[model samples]
Target: MSQTAGVKPMAIAGRAVSERERCLGMTDAERAWRKQWLKDQVLASNEPVHVEELWRERTNPIRRFYRAPLDKIFSGLSGVLGAERAATYRYITGKLGLLALGILGIHYYFKYNGNDWTKKGGWRVLKSKPLVLPGQEGFPYKSDRKQPSDYAERGFKKAAI
Candidate 1:
């Protein structure tokens, strides 16, 4: 009477027909018959099909299993070098290490040698005058920002000479 009820019967019938079709399609005799039909269609001659010969002629076994010699060489080298050496080599070759080393060397040289522009002596030179900067008042080095008065007392001007 209702549309929903009318649709239920059609749905049930459709499911039953699909199930019947699936069962019919799955029978061993049906499979055998289909195989025989396919074999008949594919193989015209009565002689046995040489699947291996066909595969060999059509597909390359060497290409399927082929590997580049360099890949093997690198893998072997990795095994020989061990993890530490490989990681070290990778790090040393990277830009970060070089940049870091350059920064560190510059910092060390500047810290010890002192910048030429500032006229502030190196650590050894600072021992006598103790080069004090503008902002640094109590601190010894002219570079110290805390001692602002010492820089003024030392007549330290910010202008580049």
Candidate 2:
């Protein structure tokens, strides 16, 4: 004759229904009500709560798969190397992993493309030279002759004197 709160105990052929069966038998309205009730409880507690924490089934499967192995590795490292050294190893390994990935990407990119960028004029094939002829205006140099500017003449003339 005992019953739990929020659950309506149903007798099927004079036997009590299991928790999973009771949950499965709930309608859409019941599910929605339960969700709202949980939300209300969270609000009343005034504590930070995630949607995943609210529902056990809402965990990311991919994250879960990677987490176990990573946790094991981290714990093993911590035990062997101590916490500080373990953190350093994690940081170094992460950077090395990223570098390796970058190197592999660059290797594949160059292998597939092979001088196609130069062919497409993305880069110069030869060293560039000044387009102007010697006699033309806007030429590069006047024979590298250092002509004294007005400021240099004024400053240096007095200094030399």
Candidate 3:
């Protein structure tokens, strides 16, 4: 008896068939039909399957670095101190401190070693008596002149008397 004949003929009609025959004993035509049926079943299942090649290619080494034990420990330490406070302290104690010190050093160096401001032409120009333009008031040199007071009629005591 033939292998297909001895086995009861599978009902290809609508029936909940749980068991499946292995493709090894199936003829070329039977195998092709089975493949198409399996493909249709998978498409109808509405489940997602990851493509192995794409998944392998997309995995990142940097993600591993972030997940490393030492990195996690350091991140926890910074979190405990508060991220903003830790960052500010790091800046002040690191390059920012050096930059501030360098600026102060430059200012002091110029202050002590540089030419005096009074000796410069700009300072001399500023210090000299301002030139009075036409129709402009000149500096009053009279020390004995008393200023007119609005409070004089208001019963305020006059210091001059």
Model 2: worst 10 consecutive residues (lDDT sum) = 116-125
The segments of candidate 3 whose C-alpha lies over 4 angstroms from its true place after superposition are 1-79, 83-85, 92-96, 116-161
The top-ranked prediction according to TM-score is 2
Candidate 2: what lDDT?
A: 0.58
lDDT of 1 by residue, 1-161 (tens): 68586666443223223556756555676566656655655655645654867766866767434423433544466677875575565555555656988999988886767544445665422335565666788564544446656443333455555
State the lDDT of candidate 2 residue by residue for 83-151, as single tens digits. 778878776776787799999988777665544322442322233445777778877634332564532
Pairwise TM-score winner, candidates 1 and 3:
3
Who is ahead in lDDT, 2 or 3? 2
Compute each candidate's TM-score over C-alphas.
0.21, 0.32, 0.22
Judging by TM-score, tell me the better candidate of 2 and 3: 2
* Clash counts for all predictions: 13, 0, 0
Order candidates by lDDT, high to low. 2, 1, 3
